[model samples]
Structure formats: structure tokens, C-alpha cells
Target: MAEHANIPAGKGRSNAAILVACVAFVAGMVGMSFAAVPLYRMFCQVTGYNGTTQRVEQVSSVILDRTMRVTFDANVAPGLMWNFKPVEREVMPKIGETVKVHFTATNHSSEPKKGQAVFNVTPMEAAAYFNKIECFCFTDIELKPGETLDMPVVFFIDPEIVNTVETKDIGTITLSYTFYPQEETKPVAVLPAGKADGNQKL
Candidate 1:
């Protein structure tokens, strides 16, 4: 009789543990689903992967000896009222050669406004082969209404770019940019195969 009573108690304890485990499993799955968007954005930023805005601060881990992609991002303020673009559409420079690209920011706003530009390069396959000489993405950019100014990005193709046979096929490379609002921006711009018009990269 004692053994029968103990068996029932043990079974009840086992059932309670199973119920707790099931609840935990469901909660974990729900949490993962909620976190999916941010996680995906992070992946794109690191890989230039899904075209979504990236979250990586910098690309310092790439292997310089091999080939990689050189990616760039640009943003402008909405209140500033400006027309901006990278001067040069494409380039194919020798390793270690410095290249300059311009972003022409023209304020059409009726009133003078102040804003800053945020820019960065994603030297995807060429992270090691890439270096920035001058860039305006840092610090806040101040502009007056109806003012037109050119922002510059002075950079160089690392000699290591030529060392890798894969990058050799890259006779033509693209330096790209996009304008964003002053506050923190969301990855929402879906730029098509657009041209910079007359802007030239130096």
C-alpha cells in the first residue's frame, strides 16, 4: 500500500516537471521570433548580405591577402533640403593609389539649417586593400539654407588588392552612398541601379 502511494506522488512530480519544460520551450521560440528582425539587420550589415542597413561598426577582421568587397554608406538630414551624391560612379585603381569621391550637398530649404553627415565604407572583399584618407561622415555637418557644398572621401586601394588574383578581375569598382535623416536611421532605403549623374571620384 505504501509503494502504491509513493508511485502516485512520483508520477505527479514528473508531470509537473514536464509541464514546466513545455512552457519553457514555447517561451524560447516566441523570444526568437521577436528578435528575428534585429538579428537579420545585423547579418546584412556584416555581410552586405540582404541589402538591409548593417550594424557592424567597422571591418577590421578581413583577410588582406585575399579578395573582398568595398562597400560604402551615406546619409543626409531631411530638414536640410539637399541634393547629394558621390562624384565618381566607378573606379579601378592600382593597389595603394589614393582616390577621391565627392558628395555634393545642396540645401534647397528656405531657411538655414544645420545637420551632419554619417558615412562609412564596406571594403567587402577588399577591406584589407582599402583605406580612408579623408571622409566627412564624422562629426555633425553644418549648412546654411540654399548652400551647396561638396563633401569628400579620400581613400586608397591597398596594394594588397593587386596581390590577390580574384580582385584582379575587379577592373571596375563602385563607390556608393545614400542620405539619411539626422536621427538614428532605419534600414528602409531601397535604391535602384541609380547613377550619380556628373559627379566624379578623384
Candidate 2:
């Protein structure tokens, strides 16, 4: 009778162990899914995969006689009532020459709003050689009602681009930016009243 009674208890213990293992496995997968996005973004930024551009601290030191036409494009995601556009349509800069371009954003809505910009370079192959030294896209932007702000981007094309078979023949590169509405957060510094633009980084 005692031996028979122990059988059910042993089976229960086995089932409980399996249940715990399954729960742990599910938890691990959930954690990985949460981490995957930022990890993948970092990977893309470093490798310039999928049209992602590279970020650099210093401007390129080498300048070539060759020049490339770089065009700018801007967009605003739905729900953000803002007017965003590149100040310049296109620029022709020599390889390795640092260029500064401006973009303007105006908040047309009645309330203050926040936005974050994402950027990419087309001719996907050329993204690997296009580098940004300083850009407004690096952080979130805030604008009060009826306020207009001018943002700047500083970048350069790598001279080695001409040596790379994949990008050597590329004549033009297009850089595009899209702004999406962001939830309200810590306020960003704003320009003094009556000032439409300022040199300060937003």
C-alpha cells in the first residue's frame, strides 16, 4: 500500500519541475524580445546596414577633388502638427569636405509639442561612407505654439568612397529625415521670444 501511494507523489513532483522550467524559458524569451530592438538599432548604426548612416566625432581630414550632389528630404509623421523642411534642396561638396545644412521646423498646433527625428541615406551602398559630425537628429526637439526653429546638420563624405567598388560610381546621395511625435518629457531649452532661430543646439 505504501509503495503504491508513492507513485502518484513522484509523478506530481516531475510535473511541477516541468512547469517551472517552461515558465523560466518563456520569461527568458520575453526578455530577449524586449532587448532586440535597441540592440538591432545599434548594430545597424555601426555597420550602416539598411541605409543607416554613420556618426563621427571629428570631420574627415582628407578632401578629394571629386564632388557629389547630396539632396535633402524631410517628413513629419501623422499626429505631429508641425511644418518641417530642409532649408536647402541640394548641395555639391567635394569628398571629405564638411558641409553644414539647415532644416526648419514650426509648431502649427495650439499646444507645445515634442518630436524625434530619424534619418537615413539612400543609394544604400553610400550610407557606409556618409558620416555626420553633428546633427539635430541626435536628440528630441520641443517647440512652443507658433514657434519656428532652425536645426543644423554637419556631415562629410568619406574620400575612400571613390575607392570602394560598391560606391565609387555613385553620383548622388539622398539624406532623408522623418519626425515622429514623442510623448512629453523634460523640456528642451528654447530660444528667447521674438527670435526665430538661434545657433544653440536644441
Candidate 3:
């Protein structure tokens, strides 16, 4: 009887150990799931994957003679009652030449609205070479009823873009932005106080 009892006790301890290990594994997975989004965003920012462009304060001094056409595009996500578009349809700039462009957003609804923009560039290969010094993306944009604002983006194409075999033949790159309504219940703070256009980076 004693021997039999010992066997059952040992089996119960083994089962409990297995249960604890499984729970720890599951918790670890859940933690990673929460971290996945920001991690992927950092990866995209670094590698320019999925048309993501690099952010920098300044670019190289070497300006290439080669010119490239840059097209602007804007869109609004569903449920966001706003009119958003690029002020300029297209611009021709030499490689490494910094250019500034504007996008206008108007809130057509009666109440205040908050939005954030997701941006990308194409042909996708050029994304790696497209650098932005300041942009309205990655920040909350709030607009009062009937408010219109001009958003600015300052950027340059890396002069070394010509050296990349993948983007050598690309003559045009399109920078696109899409605004989606923020789902948070509380209103997010708007851009810092500055010019009427609020072109300053926060």
C-alpha cells in the first residue's frame, strides 16, 4: 500500500510541473503577440520594407544630375469625414535635392475629428532611398469642425539612389499617404503650436 501511494504521489508532482511549464510558455507567447506590432514597425522603418521610407534630419551633399518625378497621393479611410489631398500633383526634383510639399485636410463633419496617417513610397525599391526630414505621419492630427490645415513634408532622395541596381531604371517615385480615424475614446493632442499650417515636427 505504501509503495502504491508513493507512485501516485510522484505522478501527481510530474503532472503539476508539466502544467506550470505549459502556462509559462503560453504567457510568453501572449507577451510576444503584444510586442509584435511595434517590433515589425521598427523593422520596416529600418529596412524600408512595405514602401516605408527612412527618416533623417539631413541628407548627403552630393546631388546627382539625374532627375526623378515625384507624384503625390492622398486618401481618407472609411468613417473619417474629411477631405484630404495633395496640393501638388507632381514635382520634378534632382536626386539629393530637398523638396517640400503640402497636403491639405478639411474636416467636413460637425464635431472634432482625430486622425493619423500611414505613408509609403513607390516604386517600392525607391522607398529605401526616400528620406523624410519632417512629415505629418506617426502623429495624431486633430481638426475642429470646418477646419482646414496644410500638412507639409520635407524630403530628399538619396543621391546614391542611382547606384542601386534595383532602382537605377526607376524614373518616378510616388509618395502616398492615407488617413484613418483614430479609435481612441479620448481626443489626442494636436500638433504643437506653430505656423497656421503646423508644419513643424513635434
lDDT of 2 at 186: 60
Tens-digit lDDT string for candidate 3 (13-43): 9999999999999999999999999999888
lDDT of 1 by residue, 1-202 (tens): 4554346878899999999999999999999999998887556545444332223223333333433334443455455477776565555444455556677777777765556654334334544344555666545565677888888777665555565875556543444455554654577765444334645445
Better of 2 and 3 by TM-score: 3
Error of 2 at 199 (Å): 52
Best by lDDT: 2
Candidate 2 lDDT score relative to the true structure: 0.94
Off by over 4 Å in 2: 1-10, 185-202
- Model 3 residue 172 CA deviation in Å: 0.5
lDDT of 2 at 7: 62
The better candidate by lDDT, 2 or 3, is 2
User: In candidate 2, what are the lDDT values of residues 18-123, reduced to their tens digit?
Assistant: 9999999999999999999999988878988988899999988899998999999999999999999999999999999999999999999999999999999999
CA-lDDT, candidates in order: 0.56, 0.94, 0.91
Predictions ranked by lDDT, top down?
Answer: 2, 3, 1
Task: Determine which window of 10 residues in candidate 1 has minimal summed lDDT.
Answer: 50-59
